[model samples]
Target chain A: MTDESRPGVGPVSLATVAAQAGVSIATVSRIVNGETRRASAETVERVRQAIKAVGYHPNQLGRALRNRESRLVAMLAANLDNPVMATIAASTEAALRQAGYVMILCDTHDRPDLQDDYLNAMRSQVVQGYVMVASQPSPGLRDFVERGAPMVFVSRRSPFGECSFVGPDNIAAGSAAADYLLDRSIEEPAVVYPSRESSTTRERVKGFCDRVIARGIPADRIRRADGPGISHLEIGYAAAQHFSAPHAWPRGAMCISDQVAYGVHRLARESGVQIPHDCEIVGIDGSPLNAWLAPWLTSVEIPHPEFGPSIVELLVSLWGGEPPREHLMPHRLAAALER
Target chain B: MTDESRPGVGPVSLATVAAQAGVSIATVSRIVNGETRRASAETVERVRQAIKAVGYHPNQLGRALRNRESRLVAMLAANLDNPVMATIAASTEAALRQAGYVMILCDTHDRPDLQDDYLNAMRSQVVQGYVMVASQPSPGLRDFVERGAPMVFVSRRSPFGECSFVGPDNIAAGSAAADYLLDRSIEEPAVVYPSRESSTTRERVKGFCDRVIARGIPADRIRRADGPGISHLEIGYAAAQHFSAPHAWPRGAMCISDQVAYGVHRLARESGVQIPHDCEIVGIDGSPLNAWLAPWLTSVEIPHPEFGPSIVELLVSLWGGEPPREHLMPHRLAAALER
Candidate 1:
């Protein structure tokens, strides 16, 4: 039982306890595996004492295989480096733990090959379900969908459209961003985005463009700055080159995300372009940290804290054989409008 | 085997494939589990064909139990909401994946109770090893250490001083910060920290205070500001109140982390104090994002990217039965001092 006694020996096993208790291995196995009905009460007590004496650790892997349940849930995220994704991951992990499931997080790094590898690995591990965050369509994902796997997509919808989704109404968020800028007397506001590859970004851009054009702002007058869709900060920093000049700057600008907005702000400062006085900027992804770390940024806030419980609820419903449904969480502009 | 034909049917099992192949279940299991040497070539061919036809997925849980290897690693982090932690998690996950292991992340939220729960849960799941990030000593942790579990502490050393550690040299980083400020002709400087509960913060503060005092500054003039140790940003923001006024402002300041430095900067700007000109500030945790998003923050950069591979390597060494060792990664100042 003590380290001093077991110098280079392997972990204590059922056989060791069985030998120590003067019982058959079957009796020890039955007692250790919770099949005590097969053994007498006195025999079970003897086996328990032997197990404690030998420091026997039950093999959960064997138990999980026999029960056909690992109680392991996998979360395949596009990137964990993003604050939004990290926030969602933290909340989801807490929620999963509360539900008696351990969450296995795999970062796909936004690569299809990596996603495929993680999916295959998680499948082999026999995870009960999955939560995909900003996932992309891959053959492995399609196979999971075809096989009727329980999954929920967060911050993005499944391209296959069969799984449940939990995210903000990004289109409405974009429209709100546009309206906020226009209401501040800024005409010909610019919209900066990394790429339209993601549904969130594509829909947000669509909503902003449609609303601005409907309000009589000429399509050509509304500047649209797009970048290589890599790092959000890099995208915003690159976009700033086209708008940092006093003559080129729009009276107002909306960035795809808070990180991008920060990039724009950093570049503008370096370029001697004063915010509010020269041009106002707004961002999305109202991360809670912004309240203390980034008070200057005005953004449409997504309910990141609710994402964990909502996603878990949707996943549990899926497990109960409920029809897949979409859950659209609300978004609102955060921070004061005044410069 | 198709979804339509197998409507309401359970997943294909080894027996299903064995029946389809006209072979014993044991024979089919052998071929599927990569023990083809036990079966004839024709039998292996038949089992492979039947597996494809019946859409059977091997139960890795069973094989893992037999092999005594789960290929599962758990990472226990204090907080994931912090960008530094998020960056480390992403890189660590990638490195783990590259090593053919899946990482299950557990956020302890800096609570010992949560840490205990995660430790117990991970133990039940039979993780091969652990990577503790800013871990606090707990009974479960002590049990693991006593039992000789393979674990490595990242960003902080084990409070028990019995496990491998992979992190930056905090003392050197703090000394670098002090020298950076002193070289800039700032006679009086302030140090803002959340708490000294963590080894990283404690060492950094000790290094800064020691170096400054050795260089002839009075210990009382060091102006150490400590907060409730809840939120790093709030700590910095609160500390800023003591130095916002012109009479109270030190010519220079050193913050615990980049997040805390951002809080100070935000507060100073609101209080009409200009950075660099009013009070030169330095921060630790040179997050890669700072290059594009926070060009104004001069920080001592910890090589976040290198942490992943280094931690993985240390864990592998421990698994190989090597003695526990400490890895102190190098740190240096990032960005221009002219800011």
Candidate 2:
């Protein structure tokens, strides 16, 4: 009755351990899988010894086949080159690890086809869950979720479908920036917003511009320029150059991210436009590193330490049913002038 | 005979397509698996239509089971928050993807136990290869390599075992920094070296200190302080405070990384010290962002753009057998002194 006589069970399996320990297959399996409460003390020890004697590496894949789901979680990132993305990713990965799952990091490089391919691959792997910083949600993504995949969208909610999302309240973040500029009584305020339109980006821009116009500041007074989704620093620098050419440099500027603000600072120095004395600048995404590395980032900052972990928690909560509601992480505007 | 009559094959498997099309299994497989040129056009078109009608999802898992390997590549990282590490990962992941493998990122957070657990889990999963920036090599790492896992170390060679390494020549980078400081006639030079001892860091410190001693200057004149391996910027800020308390502030500081240099600059500004006029700083890891964000960083820098991709290339060349030797990429001192 030994599995050694079976054609394909192989020499290193639960049957082999059971045969060696002179126990039932059920007893050996329970011991190997850490369900040892039912077995006798002597039996547990015997099976443990047998496992080592046979050099048995527990077959997680075969176990996963029975569960019909891999303990692997796949993350689709728009791009990995961005440090902010890293900040988000680091947070998500740490949280997932704590919950007993491994993450497969896939960078779609913002291409629809590549994103589709990874989604297709995920099905083949039977991964337990999906999380993403999606770029232009396609039918492939919707299809994955529709098939009842445990998925959560981070940074921006999917425009194509209603689902769980965990990110900063961009509208509020944007409005806060406008309020800061207005309270300082600055004239000729401007912005460097990314050309890419996510619900997240669009909300930030609308909040800022709408608040400015609401306060009787004409829309024309708010000079605006486009930056790409990634590499906002260089784009911010170029935006500065473009803004400088049209007229007198604005006395104050609001940037969508810290990199854009840094870019503006660098270009202004090159052009001999003194900060604060000539023109003051403020930015969003108040990264902790900005405090030490780019003090010039003096505006709305997302709470990364709290934001990242929350995304993972939200995903886990949805395991049994729907997420309670969309989670909104907090943001801060550090208005204290560079000390 | 129809695959419907087959005992075990699923409805959407390759066998189903073959049976429905009245063709041999090999002909259906070649066309379905992208071996289109080997099959006749009539056969290819018939198979393609059958695939659509049946909604066949390719069974990569079954193929992997037969081959006794997974197409997944596992990367063990020390820290992902640091942008320099991101550069290495981006390069490695991109190259691996182009070669038809997906990367599973595992950050050990510089813990030996976590490293060992990940190594153990890797064996359970049958990951085809391993690449790492090992914090401190242990028996777990040794066992994996001894068992013939395809592994390539980046940043520095294994601290415990012989292996293929692809990273900067830290000693050369260090010596070059020393030359820059001395040539500038820095009166009271200092260094902010990482407290962690990797072969890379050890060589850099040794090179810098050795070169200083070789010169007419005494070793004591070279002010020395410690910074963390990652988070060099904040640590640099702290190190600046540590260095400032002991006698006069050094005029030039050699930082272990560019982030450290930026930290020093921030601290100096707070202390009312002028850069270049008061304290000139040079750093290693010449990140491209340093050119714009930290023009103040002047010293030998890692060719990340070159170094990252090279690590991947080296790992690939060693796939069939051991790499003939480790790779040492080039570095340069950017002394342009910002515009």
TM-scores of the candidates are 0.93, 0.88
Clashing pairs in 1: none
lDDT tens digits, residue span A248-322, model 1: 888789998888888787777777787757878888889775665455678999988889999999988987889
Q: Provide the RMSD of all predictions against the true structure, rounded to 1 decimal.
A: 3.0, 5.2
Write out the backbone clash pairs for model 2: A286-A301, B286-B301
Docking class of 1: acceptable
lDDT of 1 by residue, B210-298 (tens): 88887888888888776666688787888788774766888799997888887787788777777867888889999775665456678
Task: For model 2, state the Cα shift of residue B315 in Å.
Answer: 2.7
For model 1, the superposed segments whose C-alpha errors exceed 4 Å read A1-12, A20-57, A336-338, B2-11, B37-43, B336-338
The 10-residue segment of model 2 chain B with minimum total lDDT is B2-11
lDDT of 1 at A245: 63
- RMSD of candidate 1 to the truth, in angstroms, is 3.0
Best candidate (score: DockQ):
1
What digit string (tens of lDDT, one per residue) describes model 2 on residues A1-339? Answer: 332322112225677788889999999888878898999999999998987666566766566655554667778888777777778788888888888877778888877788878877765665667787755577777655554556778887875566778888888888999888888898568887667766766888888999999989999989897765457777788778766642478878888877778888788878878775677777888766676656555679787666557777777776666653588888877863472
The Cα error of candidate 2 at residue A5, in Å, is 23
